[model samples]
Target: MGETIDAGGVDLWVERRGTGPDVLLVAGLGDTAEAWQAQLDGLADRYRLTAFDNRGAGRTPLSEEPLSVPRMAEDAAALLDALGIPAAHVAGFSGGSFIAQELALGRPELVSSLVLVSTCARPDAYFRSMTGFWHWMAERAPSERAMLEAFFLWVYTPRAHADGTVARIVEETLAFPHPQSVDAFQRQLASFVRHDTLDRLAQITAPTLVLAGELDLATPPRLGRVVAEGIPDAEFEVLPGEAHQPFQEVPDLFNARADAFWREVGARG
Candidate 1:
């Protein structure tokens, strides 16, 4: 089957594998459908896994229109509609978690359940400063490698750094054909900084699981706590000795946690 789908005005590149209960995986800032590679590999055996590139990432073109959380949530909704899915378990990471929250609130029926990973309710002063610094680095970094190197510091834990996982990922990213442009990275970051759902999170009705990494410096456990507290009945857990991108860092454990939660949600319904 073809990869790209006409999601409203944008052609979003999507990949689907397996054929059980539907699962939609949303990617984070400067990421593509490829971000969920681990999930697809680990959990597709038991679920229909669909992952896609957001606007300005992967095969999705960087539209002239500025990106926003609600707009991207609409994009996700469009993908589900076009695919003929009534609802699916949704899992999102980092910036993608913001998109998941908005999607659940905006189109509650489209989301059967949600797993928000390394998410925050709102950006704090430090968050703002870090994003601002990344914005500067995106434009001023001597090379794309340097930009990625800078990003790795916050995305992965020291364990990954010492274990060659970080280097392997950097090489793979550099080798990937559809790399996100500096402008695209900055544009996504722009929308991310503007996302604020702290006051409105209570409206999310879907079964929710919020997970944070103990070592996550970007959106710390405290930030993830705020999100969990806002959403009534949303379960929150902190993965010990993990970092921001636990999905990538420890795919087996991450996959088990998400798969269990999703199955429980399905069983309850």
Candidate 2:
């Protein structure tokens, strides 16, 4: 079950599952705690997993406070405090990874290990233009479904399109109760474009793993490499034949890789 927790000034909708070492999962843009369903289902048996909605998404209320990567990171820290967890293995995807980067840099003590899936340390010209295009599309798309379809073009691999996966996801997202508003989406997108942590990554003391999808146009392996290279000894890997949302497209592989990394981190400590 999910509960509304006062994580700082935001009432974040939080979900917890399984037991053992704490694992915090941060969702990407336009995603909620429910977005990590595959991970919760696949990895819950081994670890205590927590997922929460960002202020501008899902059941979480959008406050007047300006949304930024650092603010979101503070909310994550506050959520950990509210749950009485001193630290956790932090993993983030896309925009969530941006927030995670800030969190690790600002509060390294609260991050046991870091996993950045489909993320970049800084936006190159292509990334900046791509994200700008996404923002523009989000603003101009005629309908919610249309917007989703346009976004999905790059989110999933071509195989997913032929496999009926995109259709199923669209149907489910349309049926979801706490759908994000266009205004909120644009606001969040603006915050995401402002994130840049390439220089500060070296300060993160936590063991880090950066995963990118070989087919992900949104955040390609090259960007993921920059993140790994900047962080002292962070490992980088590209999942072949996968796109942006590999954790959902291939849960078993994603879970095993993440679990192994966490176990290795635990063993060394």
Candidate 3:
């Protein structure tokens, strides 16, 4: 079990389990800490796993004002400060990766290593296409079921669609019982759309592992490659037949590879 703590000005939700080197998990846009359940379950036995909901999402208190990506990174750093964690291996997915990059740049002392998943180093014209799709969703105001189906196609691989993970995610989202706040959702979308980290990446010194999904239409392999290449000594990998959410689509492989990267990076420390 875990508890909520006052992080930055928000009531940040934090959870910890297992024992070993600390590993922090950051979720993607519109996702909660629970989205990392697969990673926590798989690596808990061998790592001190920490996962928290970003401000304005999940159980965490909403941001008073819409936050920029750098501010979100600061919120993450504040959460670590509240927990008295000096440093830890940090992992982030999608836009969360942008936050991780900022943490490494702004608070390097608190970051041991980095695992950036399904993210770009900088916002490019490709992000416009993805944001346009989200705007389309906003305009449609489809039923939850319909929204879930569209998002599933956008985030998961064809294999996951065939195996029913998409339906399972939809069911989980629907069962959560909370009404979706369209305003909050739009704010999260705008944050990513406005985030551009192209020049900041070269300043990141954290040993990095950039993961991508071959079949991902959003944040495609090229984004991962460019990001990895930007950081000195960064490694990159692509999960075959996977989409935007590789950890969800290929949990076993994703966990093993990510865990290994963390281990190797931590060993250097």
lDDT of 2 at 100: 92
CA deviation > 4 Å runs, candidate 2: none
lDDT of 3 by residue, 94-157 (tens): 9888888888999999999999999897667878877867766855856867877887777888
* Cα lDDT of model 1 by residue, 1-269, tens digit: 32989887679999999889999999999888777888888887899999999999988998898789889999999999999999999999998999999999999999999999999989999999999999998889898888888889999999999999989989999999989988888889999999999999999999999999999999999999999999989999999999999999889999999989988998899
Q: Count of backbone clashes for each model?
A: 0, 0, 0
Q: In model 2, what are the clashing residue pairs, if there are any?
A: none
TM-score of each: 0.98, 0.98, 0.96
lDDT tens string, model 2, 215-251? Answer: 9999999999999999989999999999999998998
Error of 2 at 190 (Å): 0.6
